[model samples]
Target: MIDYRRIGALLAGRREGYCLPQGLYNDVDVFDFDMDAIYGTGWLMAGFTCELPTPGSYVSQMFGKWPVLIVRDKQGVIRAFHNSCRHRGSMICKPGSGSAPRIMCPYHSWTYEHDGKLLAAPRMGDDFDKSAHGLRPLRIEFAAGAMFISFAENPPPFADFAEKLEIYLGPQRMDRAKLAFESTISEYANWKLVMENGRECYHCATGHPELARTFPVTMSKHFDRANDARAKEFVDTMTANHLETEAIEGDWWQLARFGLNRGAETLSMDGHHMVRKLMCEENQGYVGSMRLAIDPHCFLHATSDHVFMFSAVPVSPTETLVTGKWYVHADAVEGEDYTVEGLSELWTRTNLQDKELAENNQLGVNSPGYLPGPYSRDAEMLALRFTDWYCNTARAYLAGRTAMDAPIHVD
Candidate 1:
């Protein structure tokens, strides 16, 4: 068994406003703990609702080590289940995604309904109980146009999260959108490092020329003091844009909208919209990018014309699989409404830049001379918030407390 006390001590020793200890990032024990305490228990954004537009449509992939199958049942409800068969312990579905009237096990040919009920077993004992052997169901939550799942017996209060999410994503009508493009990249780095790289843009000026054209370099430092006239001007512009967006949407801008720099409107190479058709309902001018965070594993960016959802899946102690999905209007036609290459080009290059950054970060942290470094007082607030949540959540788990029941803290 893993040593809970030792792990608790490791978590307790984490210093605030600084990077994580080298051991926490490189040790096998800590990685396993993270998988259970964070990813397994938290409400992680798995996929969008549009992926399963019709009944019997399904998508299967490994979310951590658990092979999960997300399917739309005959009731028009999306449900998740472990992809393994109950009788012989074999994968019921293949590795990729497709549509099927029923789930069938290749090994024993056991057929199951889309709702995960065992429909037929070729030859079992005369007294076999099919009702008792249905596929194990998992906890799933839906909000806006996204679907989230949890592996823990008791997950955090998702209804509360969804209530807030609607205020941010409701106008966009994400459930009405469809997937236009998707890409996956395997990075040779720790999962924490990948998350850390995502939460800050301190390297954007030098590392990401294409993204820098649209994204402000000082975005992560929300409350920091402005150092120059240009910096002050950026802050003023962002504030004005945010207030305007809130006025139009009729809701308080909690953490939804963020202003970009260089006079760019969207995340294109030229800082403009890639498609003419808009995704959100409001036809007002481009206010800013709608940014939302679900904590620990998911971040979303919605623009006037499109939306991009990014997620990281831990593969091992030293590797992570990062996935990005691009969304547009359901009726948007290719070539006429939007080009896949145009919608995907900006983020594809940005993701590659981030992959290299994470790989090098892992290499440095793995060295014997490595030590935790202080975070910048100006920037890196989100990174600090992430580390704080991670340590506190791990502590709660060690004390046998569910995430929902733990003490709440946010900046």
Candidate 2:
């Protein structure tokens, strides 16, 4: 039996004693995951359940090291396929997203049914068994209205992942949602840099100006802002001083059942105040977003009237293509002149700041003397949780463990 208690103790000790050199930023070896790291196992969010609204509706993309296509069969089941045609090696679906009665290979024109059964190969003789040439199906499961696909045959059910997350994000908002807007970006920094920056609010006043203003960034004031310039204008107009949720570890953050893991810099230091809106529910309403990064690429964020989500699709060690999806009351998104610009702008500024910092951070880490400093216990406890997760999970995976040990809290 694996001794989890011992492993937990080992991880706890490792966290306190460890110091990561800046070189990790430039280490492409770790950033480029092994074939097993991505395709060998585990669940990855492929799309939203609502996205595939009809049978034969299909979307294709390269997920991790694997090229994948997903479709909803007439049976109302959402299924995933390898997306490669069996004969002559060709891609089956050409569009990023679409609706089709069946998948047709662009190269040889091999047709596949929505269920992935080989329908017909024109040039092939009748002697060729169609059953042997069907599309390779991938393991897929759905939960919390989200869709996920896995290469592992016996991976944990999708419900399990949802259950684990529900503990952090209350059930109310988790179930109700509607699509709003989305965007994508290719960055020159490793995916980890983006993720780590998003998890902590310590840099808000400095890195993200527009963000620091609109969001409840500082649990304190007179603490020089992260971007002292941006936070300046909205500082006073913040009509109702941010009404923080119950204090968890003296951090002035309200635990919203979820959050983003991609990194960001706070536009610390108040600047110009923009139009301020009141969303007061007894003076405590939706201030901004509560974001969480769930493992690889998936980000969940909730704001007052809607939620903005992001996914970081890792393309290379220094490049990541991102995708954003906005959801609001189904009715709220349309039936009027609506633009996703205001929402996209916030993320745009946030991303631009992170790009500047992370690229520099990447260069800095290249210095042999560079070292990542420790997080303050109170202000950065959440970020620490990730450090623990990263170190321990990587070690366990490298050690040939089939399952990750549950997190053991540090004193």
Candidate 3:
């Protein structure tokens, strides 16, 4: 049996502003704890809303160990539910995505509407309560057209985070974007290791030559807002962009844009736009890439031409599945507007490189000789912040506190 008390003690003992102890990444008990403390209660990226454009379209995946189905109802609303059939507990939707009139269980033919209402369960007695047998619903929230699902009975308020996220994503028009391509890769590393490696680009200089062509090595380090002039300038520019966006869109959110170091306008081979058309009128000229890191699972990068999204899902103590999606303008044509090769080149290469790095790091950390190391204050600040957030959130959950009550660790 797993010792919850022991895991709680370990979480409390974690060192602040540094990498976690090796056991946290390699122990089976600790991995189970992580599935509960991190993936269980937090809001997680499901997929882009655009993926389910037509009514009855659906996507299914495992959210932690829970089988989840995301579907667009006939009313054009996206809803998520436990993928199990209410009658016999068989999976209602298969893995991957497709369009369907209704979800019918392959085992017993129990049928449900796209919104999860129980429609029929043949041969049941008249006394049976069909209304009581709907698929279990999970809480869902949206930000910049990305669907976020929460398994917690009482999930945190998404308004504050969504409000801020809109500012960074509004000009990109993610809601109107269409899926260009998607790829999934499995990494032989703990989920946290995958997240930590992605939180910073310190390894990009040596690990990802193709990605570094447009990404600046110097800009990878954490900036000091109090002392760094460039940091202040970036903030000022974002503020100006927010104001300009609010003036045009009739709504404003806090902190909009930031400057990218390289003259490269977007994530591509030659440091230029990958698509012929651009989003938002203000972005007639290259406005630089806008990035957002939603802790625990999702990372987003948006340019005038397209948006790239990444989600990290834990499969086991030693394995994680990383999914990447590229979104372009819904009207974009493959032959004339943008090529998939051009849109996916940078992140596809970077993702493969980071997979190797994380796997190598996990192998070392899994060894008995490995020990916790100090985090670099400059280059690895984001990684440190990520660890801090994880520890704090885990501690709070163990103490029976509200998940959102933990300190906000932002970049």
Candidate 4:
């Protein structure tokens, strides 16, 4: 049985600016709690609209324990479904991307139309009501060409998030972008550790030399940015160029634009354009990077030449699936404009390095002597923010569960 009281105590006792307790990182019960309270309730970036470019296109994946299907219907409207057939709860779509005129359950041949209306059931009696047996639908929304979904009946407000996304990502024209390359790496680490490693660049200088070539490692230090003349000048230059320079933050999301290292246009090994076709309207390169991060699951970085989408998904108590997708202009040709190797090299190398680091961290955290450690205030502010958000959200969830489970007496 899961220990909800222990989980609540751990969350309530978490120290500010320190890493989470060891149990929070390696406990199976905590993992289940996170899947229910965090992943189950929040909006997650499932797939891009470009992945569903045409009518009948679809992508299916397991969001925690929920089998989610995102599809573009015959009317070209993107939709999300629970991905389960109503008859026996068997999954209707296989994992991965494909184009299908209708969703068919391989187990029982229960079929559904593109919009999730039940079409046929081979063995069911004529009295069966197909209309009431349609696949279950989930809440879905779109912003800046990216698809977001929620399993919650009443999801958190999205208007503010969508408005901020448009301000930061609209100029990139992600709707006109196409997936150039994609990869998923299994990291033997806690999902929080995977995200914490990504939220800070304290390891970038020595750990990710390839990424450090184009990305400024020092720019991650929030305290240093205030007094750094170069950082201010970079923002000034970006503003003078009429680009979006605002840094917007909310409870569960952040949107900001930052300049890359000198002479770097996009996150390439050589600090040059990886694709011939630009993503935005900028005539020249060096448009900098626009970053958007939604807590717990999604991170995006868009440059003038291309865009990168990342998601850290929990597979178990100590395992995470890190998926990365590289996107370029829709018209970009493989050999002439960009090669898959060129478009994905920098991030691929960086992701592999991070996987090793996170796995090692997990191993150490699993040790008996493990204890939470303090974060560097300057370099690890974002990491600290992530932990704070986790604790607060988990506390709220546990409180609500307690209230719901409490017995009632006759009044």
Candidate 5:
């Protein structure tokens, strides 16, 4: 149904390093046909590790359109299981999160351990082996403080993926930060738009005045993997360990960028007490700690003191549900200062800015008169890369190819 060779050419490009025409962003058909590029194949960070801090914790989450459950077993190892009942395919867990030694299917009361081992099922003939009907398990891996699950059989290991993209992520992913709060929203634009918008900071010069006041726009350019040779070498180092961010600089935005002096903090062994105060003065209120990423479909904003990740899950070609999770030190959260209001305000503002623009832009693209607008190279790169990846991956899926099975190319 699609031309794989032509799609590869669009992604490979002739002169733009790597680029695609604007039609990908405008076509409704593209979204409908290629939904799996996002919902399938590549890794997705689902259900934060902190949410399942102890053995026997389980949560119901969705992998794109399919529902999934992640559980921590008695052995303290986490596992992913399809949440549907083995009998009528009814959903087993109704709650979003909780602790249970064995998951009881609501429809027929079949039971499975948190590790996804099928322990017992109701009403089956004696000859039916419960072991053969265990809840199906997915490939699972961890990076820093977060966890990722993939449905594809034998998906690439998290360590292998990270090792290929090394230095980009410091040493470990910032997963240890305890979750303090979560914010969820239903966005009206495509999920890819949200991911693309967050990837580059070029928009900070205008659309994000608050962020611009904190970090230089140049940092976004520095982050680009195309022009920087160090970036390529760094990605290689990362793939060696499975790409994960090792440190939380201990500061959020403006304060971290300026207060530490880039050179001193660049190679420093510690980020302890990363920030005494957030970027804004008391009048603006301390913005609070955060971690940032636009990987796959996630826009993660994190800090050692707090962590929040926003993902736009596409409900259809035009609608997406945006969800956020907040994390903090276990003590800070269970104790006195775990309010999500301060950090939430900052995220909402930035999120609304993009939501407003993207939804309106979508409407315009729906009209027949829309034309390709000139894009600034920097802020636009994030969106551009998403477009490239979306088209390329879709074609790859059509051809039965995948990011994991592709030739390793970090070097």
Candidate 6:
């Protein structure tokens, strides 16, 4: 049996400025708890609006154990629903992108509208209520052009984070963008390892040579920007260009715009725009990359020419699926405006390197002599924050569970 109290204690016992206990990385019970407590409760980035361009367009994917189907209705509204059919619980949509006038269950021919209303149920009695058998709906919200869904009964407020996303990403005009390319890679590492590796640039200099060519790795290190002349100058330049320069962070999200290396326009091998057409109409010259991170699942980087989105999906106790999506102007043609190889090279290489690193890290942690080590105070602050958030969230969930399990006295 899993000991909830012991798990809570383990989370609460984490030392500051250090990595988590070894068991937290490889324990099956801990992984299951995380699926329920963390990913289950948080708002996850489902997909972008461009993925479902026309009415009836939809994409289905598994968020933890929840099969999510996101679709555009006849009225042009984006909607989400549990992919399972209302009848015998078969999946209405397969795991990928497709288009259909209505969702149909291949097993029994039960059909549902794009808005999740039950439309046709053959061979059912007149007493059967179609209204009562509609598909189960999930809570969904949009920020900029991306869709976020929460499985929680009462999810956290997204208004503030949505506002921040607009401030940083709205300028990109993602509504007019298209998903140019996408790829998913399986890593033999825990989800936390993949996230911890992404939350910092401590390994970029030594591990990602291609990314370092254009990206300013030092900008990721935590420091007092107000007193730093370089930071002040960059902010001034961006402000003069009518761009957002400040960084905004909350408990579960962070958004910031940072300058690239000198003479670099975007994140590319040649330091030039990959797409011939710019993403934002007002962008006449170089505009820094706007980076946004939503806790527990995804991170996004939008440049003047394109946007790159990354999401880490937990697969098992010792495995994660890291998916990358690249978006560019909808009118931009593949060969004429941008090539897939050029558009995805920098991040593609970096992700592969990080995958190897994370797998190796997990292997070391699985050893008997493995112990938590100190995180670099300056370089690994983001990683520290992520770890802290995970522990705090887990402890809160465990505390709630304990309270519910406790015996009540007669009044």
Estimate the lDDT of model 5: 0.55
Q: In candidate 6, how many Å is residue 294 off?
A: 0.7
lDDT per residue for candidate 2 within 1-411, as digits (tens), equals 434344434444443533343433444555544235433456677757666767888878776446889998999888998878899777777637879877889887889989989998897997989999899999887655667787777764455546544433332243445455666666677666666666667787777766666555554321234354433433332323442222122111113321111122111123211112211222133233444455545666554455566666566666666676765544443424235664456766687787777677666666666666777664555556555555555455555543454553422
Q: What's the true lDDT of residue 89 in model 4? A: 90
Give candidate 2's whole-model lDDT: 0.56
Measured with C-alpha atoms, the lDDT of residue 352 in candidate 2 is: 73
Backbone Cα, N, C clashes tallied per candidate: 0, 49, 0, 0, 36, 0
| lDDT for residue 252 in candidate 2, whole number 0-100 | 14
Superposition error at 222 for model 3 (Å)? 4.8
Q: List the residue pairs that clash in candidate 6.
A: none
Which of the two, 3 or 5, has more TM-score? 3
Q: Which lDDT tens digits does candidate 6 get at residues 1-411?
A: 566765765676677789999879999888888898899888899878999999999999987667899989989999989899999999878889979998999999999989898999999988899999999999999989889999889788899989888887888998999999999999999999999999998888899888988887765454335776767887888887677877778888888888788888888888999999999655464777888888997888888889999999888989999999999999999999999999999899999999999999999999999989999878888899899889877877776676677532211
RMSD of 3: 5.0
Q: Rank the candidates by TM-score, best first.
A: 4, 6, 3, 1, 5, 2
Instruction: Provide the lDDT at 117 for model 3.
Output: 86
Angstrom error of the Cα, residue 401, model 2: value is 7.9
CA lDDT, every model vs. true structure = 0.77, 0.56, 0.77, 0.86, 0.55, 0.86
Lowest lDDT 10-residue stretch of candidate 3: 245-254
Q: Of the candidates shown, which would achieve the greatest TM-score relative to the real structure?
A: 4
Superposed Cα deviation of residue 56, candidate 4 (Å): 0.7
In candidate 6, stretches whose alpha carbon ends up further than 4 angstroms from where it belongs are: 220-228, 281-283, 407-411
Local accuracy of candidate 3 as per-residue lDDT tens digits, 200-279 = 87777899887778766546444333455755665565555552211111111122234555477777778888888776
Residues 1-411, candidate 5: write the lDDT tens digits.
544444444344423434334445544554544455446665677846778878888878765567888888888888888888787898888638889868888777888877676778766878998777888887777655467777666453456444332333222234444555666666676666566666666665687654544434555432433455644454454344343323322111110111111222111123222223322221122222223443457755443234457777676666777776755555553324534555455556767777776687667756677554554565565555555566555655644643434432211
